[model samples]
Target: MESKLSRNEAISQLVLASSSPRRKELVASLDLSLPVYILSTDTDESIEAHWSPEQVVEQLSLRKANAALDLLQQKQAVETSLIIGADTIVVLDGDVLGKPVDDDEAKAMLRRLQGRAHEVYTGIACVLSSSGEAQLAHRMTKVKMKPLSEEQIARYVATGEPRDKAGSYGIQGLGSTLVDEIEGCYFNVVGLPLSLLSDMLATYDIAVF
Candidate 1:
């Protein structure tokens, strides 16, 4: 049996269009032999009010991937690399809970999420730097938060882990204590769904072997 398989020869590298440390770490876990580059971009993330969670994440992810592709083109360094972009969001009671601006907002978001189940959506986009070929997909996970008290929420908020996280928590960090149960890809809640991402990469002749 073969322990390794050949990949697309034309594809020379993998470019991640995000600065999130968690995402970077997840990509590193794949351990692909190709060189991986971090080409973060400041793409506009705004969306229409009526867009559903799926639409919101998918569009934002593709937007970032395209922005990175443009940057590579301008530098004339787009030598058959693959650009990977992703976006994750938390939805509760039909409302999107983005990153909190302050501790008060974080506590408020957590308060609403306590003792309830919410959905997490993670969208992934892959663009071939050479031919401009693009692929997009998303994964949804159901997360149930344990019932939390005001003091517990306050204590967690003081830890400062929820500051930049959606739904005021990071399931992969200290926030794990707050979750009662989860259904679907665990990586989806972390930020980038590994299974979904691997599948998309396979379409571009990239495999995890």
Candidate 2:
């Protein structure tokens, strides 16, 4: 991947189009110190029954990147900007569980997730506004949750921590207590798959180290 990056002559244009602090921290952890700029566009995350989990996240991430690309072009910065967008979703038993709508919903989501292993898919998309070039990929991690009683689930939901997270929990925060084990990239469940993003960034000549 390093060799491929060298071949592209390197791309210095970097921008993030997300409001997620978790993603911001994940990106900063690379030591890039890059600027994060949110896009003016909003996405409707409703998924169709026909789409696979990968398709759901890939489309959502690409939509966000495209929105950011549009914003950059509006500012006439298209040629000099590389915009990134990412989306994550939790899948259990072929069902997609997004962020909870309320505390009750959060508890319900957690109840179904307890004692079960679910697949978390995070999609990352990078768009070079110059020449309208784009690349998108999705990574999946299997996360097993510790069994929880109704009381435990209700308690976690009442903390308001799970309301804003997919699958009603965050593996990188206080919610980490609920996870028993993870089968793949740990950062993926946190919101961004750094290793996967590093490789994806390489295709655009963006290096992390």
Candidate 3:
């Protein structure tokens, strides 16, 4: 009985390795007994041109999780940590769209995305600090956008929401107006897939229920 209690205490904390408000909110919604700690990492996000979209997000998520683990180890605060890292990307016509650097770029990405169906791929990685074991997974959602005129795209860009979002739109915010339909996990497009995360957490003895 004491051993079981000790194991529970060992995984009493969840470290989220991301700066995304959407991800933070999603994880918090789980209401797990384990306290959540946000740890954002600025790891390298560049990917090879030939890598598949799945590979891109998975590798990036792992990198972010590992980076966060390194930070916690340096601070000597990782003894009871289970770190999660996630990366999302927008793929249209075999091309990957990342966060735009400027309004013009955002506009261009939206332009191509308008009146089309694109796939949103989000990868999640969980690293157990005590065991140094990492698990990775990804979710894909097909999103169809409403046809928008140049004026509409310009107006959306003016709001400054797309500048920091991949594919130049956020489905959970004002950008929802631009989407006509989605065929997979909605939370995946929001930057984190809760259902998938919950399952991964279970593997580490972290239960939401």
Give the TM-score of each candidate.
0.94, 0.91, 0.94
The C-alpha stretches of model 1 lying farther than 4 A from their native spots are 1-9
State the C-alpha lDDT per candidate.
Answer: 0.90, 0.82, 0.90
Give one digit per residue, the lDDT tens place, for model 1 in 93-183.
8998888999999999999999999999999988878766677789999999999999999999999999989899999999999999999
Cand. 1 TM to true fold: 0.94
TM-score-sorted candidate list, best first: 3, 1, 2
- Candidate 3 similarity to native, TM-score: 0.94
RMSD of each: 3.8, 2.6, 3.2
> In candidate 1, where is summed lDDT lowest over 10 consecutive residues?
1-10
Candidate 2 global CA lDDT score: 0.82
- For model 3, what is the alpha-carbon lDDT of residue 192? 96
- Candidate 2 deviant stretches above 4 angstroms: 1-10, 33-40
User: Candidate 2, residues 93-128: lDDT per residue as tens digits?
Assistant: 999999989988898899899999999999998877
Assess the local accuracy of residue 136 in candidate 1 as a C-alpha lDDT between 0 and 100.
79
